[model samples]
Target: MDCKSESGLEMQNVCIVEDDDAVRDALAELVESDGYRVLSYASAEEFVAGADATQVDVLIVDFRLPGMSGGELLKRLNERGMRLPVILMTGHADCDEVGLGLDVQDVSFLTKPCDPRRLLGLIGAAVDGKG
Candidate 1:
């Protein structure tokens, strides 16, 4: 799946880190259809273990995971100096919790059942350093 820009450059890679199988699969399909290379993980631990953090252009992470929370994962990434744009998804729309996650400059929060198009656009912006 080669997604080219106007200058004929390949699109960046996007990683989806979600616990739900259905959501992971669906998000992967949607992102791939948008012309970006997509990788899916069932948990934050799996993603952090398997994926090359440097290769990741954007990360779509669910706030609640089986092992570690999304914010915890982000904190780890920060400690390692692994900088990447992250979009956080959560079932809870708590302003305080979301605000805490937003303390990271490159992080964004999305409520559950997010619009696919908006998600894609945000991914694009993240990769382009425009978010």
Candidate 2:
């Protein structure tokens, strides 16, 4: 995508780091429909390598992946000083276990098959600095 708003201005960037192809694609569609520029990756490692972590306005990531978990990615980003709004999701029952001791601000959690309205609301809040 061109990452531009309808008014010919630059739009906010939202990144999704998910290993599941279907989940990632669906999330990208949802986020894009909300008018944010969406950048997606299949793994935390791919996201770390392919995109600048500091530039994205918000990050929506899966808590569990084949390689590095979402919590680890958040920790690594924190260590690198890239604090931003994050929405972490997972199908596992141990949702509370994610992002326990991370210094990143504006963090929210969502279970798998999350409500689109709630997700969009969180994204809006994050973008508006209310998260």
Candidate 3:
């Protein structure tokens, strides 16, 4: 979907990297309703392979995946000089543990089943350069 604003201009691109089909679809719906372009991926590898740094403004990723983890993806993105704001979600009690040894910045953490309002607020802050 094209990220379009009310003034017929482009909006920030928000990517969702979620392995779970249900979660990915749900998030896409919610974020799209909020007017940002939603690019949903089933895995971090797909996102890494297909994402365009110039277009993406923020990322919402699942922290735990079947293969590469969210921290690894964030590190890879940073290594590639993307530097987009990110929100990582997980069920783990200590999500920060995954970020150990990573130089990731402009990142926020969210537990699974996060409040929709909170997620939207974070995305707004990230897009506005206030994250």
**Candidate 1, superposed: residue stretches over 4 Å from native:** 1-9, 93-95
lDDT of 2 by residue, 1-131 (tens): 35567898878999999998998999999999988899999999999999876678889989898898988988888887778899989776766677587655568888988999999999999989933
Best by TM-score: 2
What would the TM-scores of all predictions be?
A: 0.86, 0.89, 0.88
Clashes of each: 0, 0, 0
| Candidate 3 residue lDDT tens string, 1-131 | 44567798877789999999999999999999998888898989998788776678889989888688887888887787777788988787756576674555678888989999999999999988842
Residue pairs in candidate 2 whose N, alpha carbon or C atoms collide under 3 angstroms? none
lDDT of 1 at 43: 84
* Candidate 3 residue pairs that clash: none
Rank ordering of all candidates by TM-score, starting from the highest: 2, 3, 1
The root-mean-square deviation over C-alpha atoms between each candidate and the true structure, in angstroms, is 3.4, 2.3, 2.4
- Give the alpha-carbon lDDT of every model: 0.83, 0.86, 0.84
Report the Cα lDDT for candidate 3.
0.84
Better candidate by lDDT, 2 or 3: 2
Name the weakest run of 10 consecutive residues (lDDT summed) in model 1: 93-102
Model 1 gets an lDDT of 0.83
